[model samples]
Target chain A: MAEFDKNMDFPELDAYFSKTSEAADDRMALLELLKRGAVAYRGTEELRKKCLNARELLPKEYRYLEFAGLQKLIEKCKIFDLKNYSRELIKCIIIGVCYYTLFQSIAASAVIFILCLIVMVGGGYMTHRKNAKKLETYYNLAVELRGVFPELELEEDYCSEEKLMSLYDIVQANELTSLESAVVKLKAIG
Target chain B: MGKEIQWLSFKTREQKQADLDEYTRWVFKYGQPQKEKVEQILSRLFPKEAPSMAMMTYLLGRDAYYGRYNTKKSSDRNPIKDMYDVLSKKRYQVPKKDIPLYMALIIADERVSEALDYPPDDVLHVVAARLMEQE
Candidate 1:
């Protein structure tokens, strides 16, 4: 709970920890070592044991540099802009209802409106849910890839929202082949 | 009686890797694409330092939450409240003070920063926000 010594000079602390064996007592020094990606501490047995203990004392998320690094990347992703999505969906339903009221009888419009609402909400929810799930999977894969290939720089391969959106569209387009197959079967039967 | 402090727990390695096979399949299905557009935008907006997209999003979300677009009064803005709103939207349960510390830890961590390499005037924005709370 100690405030980061606001004046804590990085270069000076780096020098201090690099030279002294007393770094094990300093949480910041342990963090410095973790920052250096020098997890395998090559030091005196007492220093190494103490450093290990210090690492254990640090937040678990900070303990593994890879997780911390990958997490930084995953955090970049905007899985679902839920607020924007709901706002747009509501605006759309309002407009659709107004159009229906102008064009149809009240009883018919009410039935149609209820059906449209269900379809719009259910369909929107499913699509967003799928996209969110896909993005989460993508993030987890990025995280796990760090462990399997520590040398790999995941930032270079990070997916963007635009790319993912386009890819999802392409995947959906490809999925239409199943519908095509069913149509061909029906045509032959007819 | 003194209050007991409970430290945060980490995910177990086994739990972490449990669905690696499924994850690999998913990643392969989606395919990894380089975020060149994001890089371009970040480079243009923050020519000096790389503020992670997460940081950028948090700042933007904070502004949106405050209806900054509609308000002209500087007194109406509250950075601490905005920060909490953004964190809550993400469902994070971190302590307010720890939030800045966590940001500083990641920003200063060399290995992590290397992965997040870009540019930031936004870095100053982050530091300023933290210092604002300190004062």
Candidate 2:
């Protein structure tokens, strides 16, 4: 399928649609995935609002970088996890614990390390890193925004801390496929 | 109270409150720390649980400038709210419905100035509002 290979940007999302069956089980699974995406999309909207508010209030020193990071996050929020590589992720974690347990045996530990790497790499750990990088840029931008109002934040009732920290955590804690779920949810809703 | 009269009064009060809220939201938004500072001082000066009325907004505009224009010479308190107790006086009582527009004029007036305590100048949206207000 040369045509399919050319068009499929997200191989993980492709896995979901590759199945031929329109069976109830598959339909339910898609719905569940879409629901996760919807939740992630809401998170994305909150982040976008923070970006806009900070962009407005603060000087433009970090505007380009902040906006760029925010743009990547917005895009990611639309495409995160679609293949459900969570099982593989869990396996990698288990193997990691075992690898540590057997680290005294260098040869065996190296083999285990290789296995873990293969599993993690296959499970879209690269995508996680890409997303994490985007999140770091946004966090840096937020720091710049916070720098603008150092004294104001010291007040007890100010909500800026909540806005910065909660949004950063939302971006950081989201699953790799969180955006994919959001895209599917939007499509289903539409 | 009669049902019709009570309902009308309630509606009027709600509409007035909504207008005040909208006006304050605008000031808070564009005015930045100056407006926020004014709000903080006013909230402290009043320290009442009563719902916001036009007097509070008017007092903030009338006082809270850098210096002068106050009965008190202490130099710390907002003159309009602290010296005059403008809200307590009956003549200064702005009609409920007119509070928002009235306060807008006061906050945005050319004579009023934002305190220079914070940096970057132009804390109050006075110049912007004056230009927009064409005054």
Candidate 3:
């Protein structure tokens, strides 16, 4: 392993260390554990248990590496979940009740309620779709990231977000494409 | 109508050259310590056809120094992708197919610059050696 000039200033590194160490508690312990690298960090039972317990209060995603920039990019990519729509549904109901109570007109109340439902649910769905696309793009970015930094192993498969149809490319290959000629040649050879 | 080509939106030659020059200056100034290590790894790995330090430094620092890795510059493209695009067009003695390896070097170097403070700098050498083993 090569040695870095310890005297150099690195705000990004310091910021990440302080933030993550603060999150996990026991700054020295977390730093020591991180020295083992992200892949090895998961396998260490006692340290991992301690970190995981502490991490639970922060967010579901683990800080896999001390690479602050990459970690921040990963954090920005929100995992799409249908469960997030439940809040929208609850909002719709509240709006419907309010409309009915205020107007005293069932038709107007129903219309307003439906409109609110459509707007809220529709907006949520649009955002979800946009996030899904963003997630796919993020996955592709991750695939490219791992290509260069192979040592950094990710939990998700690189191709997990790729659309099935985009996986293969069709190309021309003379004899391979000419089924009839190939079949005739095959028959003659046989 | 056909979709607008994204490359059309990319910076012109003068802009790119200016960016490259700025990046090169930054690398020379701050990356002096890592230069020997990078050169050492390059010489060891590509003994027969080592790339020039100028090219390596340019590619390594181009995005990281410019803060392109930050989320504020939101775009479909990234540092690795930009490097890949450059490598494809330019003859850097580095094959376009081996982008992953170069990318690893560049990214590891970027991490160091960004101060992945805990693992220490030896990790960079470890990564280079590990990559060498794989090659």
Which candidate number has the best TM-score? 3
Candidate 3 Cα misplacement greater than 4 A, ranges: A1-190, B1-25, B28-31, B51-74, B90-93, B113-135
Compose the digit string of candidate 1's lDDT tens values, residues A115-159.
Answer: 765677556666656544444454455444333324323221212
- Extract clashing residue pairs from model 2: A37-A181, A37-A182, A77-A179, A79-A179, A79-A180, A80-A177, A80-A179, A80-A180, A81-A177, A81-A178
Report lDDT (Cα) of residue B95, candidate 2.
44
Candidate 2 residue lDDT tens string, B1-135: 112354446556688789667756654544656566555433443345233643455444454332234544664454323322332345656443333233333433322333212211132223223322322
Least accurate stretch of 10 residues (summed lDDT) in model 3 chain B? B113-122
Which pairs clash in model 1?
B48-B120, B49-B119, B49-B120, B50-B119, B50-B120
TM-score for candidate 3, please give it.
Answer: 0.26
Candidate numbers sorted by TM-score from highest down: 3, 1, 2
Chain A TM value for model 1: 0.33
* TM-scores of the models, in the order given: 0.23, 0.18, 0.26
Cα error of candidate 2 at position A23, Å: 65
Q: List the residue pairs that clash in candidate 3.
A: A2-B122, A148-B104
Candidate 2: C-alpha RMSD after superposition: 26.5
**Model 3 C-alpha lDDT per residue in residues B15-124, reported as the tens digit of each score:** 87896677556554455545566666556545555467534544444554344444445453344445444444455545643543454456545544322222334443
Candidate 3 chain A lowest-lDDT run of ten: A163-172
Lowest-lDDT window of 10 residues in candidate 2 chain A?
Answer: A1-10
